[model samples]
Target: MSGALLEAKGLCKRYGALVANDNISLTVAPGELHAIIGPNGAGKTTLIGQLTGQIRPDEGRILFRSEDITDRGMPARVQFGLSRSFQISSIFPSFNAECNVALPIQAKAGHSFRFWTPAVVIESLRGPARELLGRVGLGERGATRASVMAHGERRQLEVAMALASQPSLLLLDEPMAGLGAGESARMVAFLKSLKGRFGILLVEHDMNAVFALADRISVLASGRVIVSGTPEEIRSSREVREVYLGEEFDA
Candidate 1:
């Protein structure tokens, strides 16, 4: 834990009598890929919300890079090098990929997007935006409008935007969601390339992707961690198989 880049301790969120996340605790070591997996209503999103500071937990604490950030807001957390991508695409449909990525870089540099001409299209930010796009495998697609790109490309763009903040930890909420077989494979390869570059907390339903990318995985069920271990350990666990993986999950 001393070397952990991110840590969640006893995270709990309740909606009246229904507990969304109950006593959840997990850690992401520096440059480690930690995957969170579970079925429907497993509170994965709620936990992610708390981690990203979009939602406050009823009881819990979050540490980022050895700093306590339980009460921090989204902007404050971003300042501390924590960034995230949403489950749904949160890109600018009308703008091109470069501009979408530039927006975050501009904001992080203490510039406002009030003036469309200057703030939105800064010559300086353009370089970094394109660099981020390249990191996410969208180097040549920077000129493409986000609205016209395929879903997989849009997802990649979202990640490029997330990286604009230069985060030490990236919380990815289902980056592989809504992709075809080929697209999914491409995403898996992209994520594999990012494995040791930064700490990644992945919340995904794709077992193959999870198994391929995670250094360790935490399986959630009924608002609690059913088990946490290496991917091979999780794949071989009887409890995890019965609760989430199922007998048919070869991964």
Candidate 2:
């Protein structure tokens, strides 16, 4: 509560008899990387959906930078420095990587309607887009078609697009969804490098990557948060093992 950049208090959502999120509460401080992990159907993604305005909670409050955003739509949230990426690729695959990156910058700059004009001529949007691609280690691939780039690099482009708005907080839903071994390693390295630059709400299943990157880990089971602790504590938690990992998770 001291300096929370994003806070979800008493969040609850029900789909018929299935409770996807039940009174879930969490706080992410400025520039902290917070990860949420759990077994399938544990409501990790549901909570993320509610937090990002994809879905509404039956009851709760969502505060961003001390402002209430529970009623805010996705675009409004983006305007307020809140950005998110989905588990699947959401970029314009037909466009060049940099073009996809630049679109968001243009959108954020209130120029999406002027399709006939050249966005590159506008320095306000173009400059930040280039810088974002460079920051994500894709400076040289700016002209590459997004559909032709490697999967790992496309994911990096997705990140670049997210950063186009200069978000203060990022809600990443399974950033490593279909990455291979080497690609996953590369993603892990990149996220570790991004550790302190922005507050992140990471929902992932890769425990190896989670331990390597998260400042704190929150575990959930059956639509409820089991516990939240440091990597060391989570690694040794008997309850987590028995509930999610079938008694052999940590053995």
TM-score of 1: 0.93
Tell me the tens digit of each residue's lDDT in model 1 across 86-128. 5444687999999999988987876455556774458878999
Per-candidate clash tally: 0, 0
lDDT of the candidates, in the order given: 0.89, 0.85
Best-performing candidate as measured by TM-score? 1
Q: What TM-score would every model get versus the actual structure?
A: 0.93, 0.92
Error of 2 at 141 (Å): 1.6
Candidate 2, residue 76: lDDT: 94
What is candidate 2's lDDT per residue for 1-251, written digit by digit as tens?
Answer: 45799999999999999989998999999989999998888998889889889999999999998889999998999999998975345787788877788878877777554665564445555567778899888998888888888878888898888888788899998989888998899888988887798999999877788888999989988888888998888888977887765533541
lDDT at position 118, candidate 1: 78
**Cα RMSD for candidates in order:** 2.4, 2.5
lDDT of 2 at 100: 85
